[model samples]
Target: MKWTYTIQTEGLTVEQLLRDEWRLSKKQVHELRMAKGILDADETPIRWNEPLAAGTPVVIQLADTVSPHVPEPNPDVSIVFEDDHLLIACKPKGMPTHPNDPGQSGTLLNGVLGYVHAHGGTYAEHVHRLDQGTSGLVLFAKHPVVKNALDRMLEDRQITREYLAEVEGNIQKNGGTITAPIGRDRHHPTRRHISPSGQPAITHYSVTARRKGTTELRLTLDTGRTHQIRVHLASIGHPITGDELYGGAADSAGTYKLHAFRMTFIHPFTGKKLTAQN
Candidate 1:
């Protein structure tokens, strides 16, 4: 795969672009250098250590890698946003983001692979995941370099993910932040709870609506942990409706009400601000 990028700042070296700006791994940099993958607009080889002027176009080339997931085409899957480097798809509630075992079909990743393969592409990977019971937008990387950049972005909290959920009780406070450590629940195989020794987790929420039996909430995460939103809300005595694992009431459809309604992030390759809503 080949992509072109123009230098936005003056006097930027190839080393700085790879190491500091794109944050490419040492192995990735070595591979590119070995392949002579970075070239000028005229297809001439560019020196890695030399500085280049602003508006200079650079072409990047990388070998295409095969996708690991099995492609079982399903038209039900929806692709919301897509570019040469990334894709964002809507995931329905009750579907796993990826398969737990090899050769598994019907998971979101498999469906995505079908779409990618059909479109003459060979690679697709999810950058982040939502629980099987949560419905929302899931971001996917079309290539390995973009995947690494996105992973770093996620660790730095540069990507924003917002969720809407209905909880079991009315929250008296209009808005609040949950700053608690989250650890695994020993008794349950797939549950998390607050613990002093656990990793730091933060959730921000505001009450959107309050009815007689439940409250609707808009939540954003500063730290992404396993079941962070559910655990934090339940810790505050307002577990999400239908999140039975967290001690909340069940819903008519027997699934959680949490939805990842919005996501915003700067495009790793194009440097464009991208937002997707469900």
Candidate 2:
């Protein structure tokens, strides 16, 4: 893959520009230098410490490496958004985000790979993940530069994630916040619970609708803990209606009532506000 950038500030060496303005890590710079990936507008090689005049265009070409996994095509996979820099998809319930164990198939990652492959592309790097039981919008980067930019944005909390869940029982309050600590369940290896010796978590919820023996909620999280939403809701005596593992009713569909409804963030390359939904 290749990307080009126009030099906006003059007198800065390539190393300085990449490190300070582009916010590239030292390791990435080293890789580019070692691979002879930097080039001037005229396709001439450029050194890491080489200084360029203003209006100079720089090109970076990444190394091509073979992939160990090949994803099979699935007609069910839905592509919600795409561009030269990013690809967004809406994953259905029951599909794992990626393969956690060897020989695993039918994951969202596989589906994305197949989609990209169908378009004569070779790579797809996911920026974040959603659990298997949750259905929602997922983002994938087309190149290492785009992936790096997204990772930084997520670390700085520039991406906003929202969800809709159906919980058991009626919530008395119209809306409220749940501030608690979440940690691994002592007894269940695959479960999470509220504990004193856990990471800080905050969940904001508002009642959206109510039905007999069930309530709909709009939830937002301040921290992205492993089962944070499920644990927090269960702690308040309102486990998700179909979350059998979390002490809610069994679901015949083999899925939960949780859905990743919306995501709001700034496009790293275009500087445009993007709002994606299922």
Candidate 3:
């Protein structure tokens, strides 16, 4: 199976990719390079000196014969918030929250791994996820109790996530709800699009800013779904800027303009109203 992952550390280079960031020693990085374990997204071989900023998406091939293919590695991340129990970092556009494929690494998960290992930290589980193109505050649970509690909170809608986005065309509504259902785009299993036969998903949005040729909206979710904001906005004829998957073309800035911006939830342990904003 083909799997894709995104880099989540800022100014990360190829050398750092195989060694330092991945917790691989210099010798180990050399070994992977020799074994053809890495490749750029375009399947080109990138030298160990190549530099990829945080949020770059990297694809690793694991099943095919290991010959010679160095996939893409792009790492970019700017933290907006953090705590002992969680990290609400501001993810750049084009970075996946985790790796869904088998037998490989290099993701937000990998970056977290490097961070933890370097500092003698703990493993954190993402209570939620963001699409490769969406940028926002991600809820990461550091400890076990925090993870379980946040998971429960998410299931119960105790967390309020607010995102900022500039979508195609002008949005007329101050606020509205998207109650469409989503499922695997059977035509493209690796991709997701809205389908009537899909599960019910509800998204709420309020117009935050608008101008000619674009509308900026504040998005909040009552339910989480794959491509929730992107699909929902596109379904309403306002695809996120630079998101060609739904409607807009890829942008030169190379980062999705969306920002998680805000989230409100109760502390998993303290029961205090927890809010993080960027």
Query: Evaluated with lDDT, which candidate comes out highest?
Result: 1
Tell me how far the alpha carbon of residue 201 in candidate 1 is from the true structure, in angstroms, after superposition.
0.2
TM-score per candidate, chains pooled = 0.98, 0.88, 0.68
Could you say which candidate leads in TM-score?
A: 1
Higher-ranked by lDDT: 1 or 2? 1
Stretches of model 2 off by over 4 angstroms after superposition: 6-17, 20-22, 46-56
Q: Per-residue CA lDDT of candidate 3, range 90-137, in tens?
A: 666666777677534555655654554454454656788877767667
Going through the candidates in the order shown, the clash numbers are 0, 0, 17
- For model 1, residues 106-215, the per-residue Cα lDDT tens digits are 99999999999999999999999999999999999999989888988998999999999999977999999999999988898999899998999999999999999999
Arrange candidates, best TM-score first.
1, 2, 3
How are the candidates ranked when ordered by lDDT, highest leading?
A: 1, 2, 3
State the C-alpha lDDT per candidate: 0.92, 0.83, 0.68
Pick by TM-score: 1 or 3, better one: 1
Return model 2's CA RMSD, one decimal: 2.5
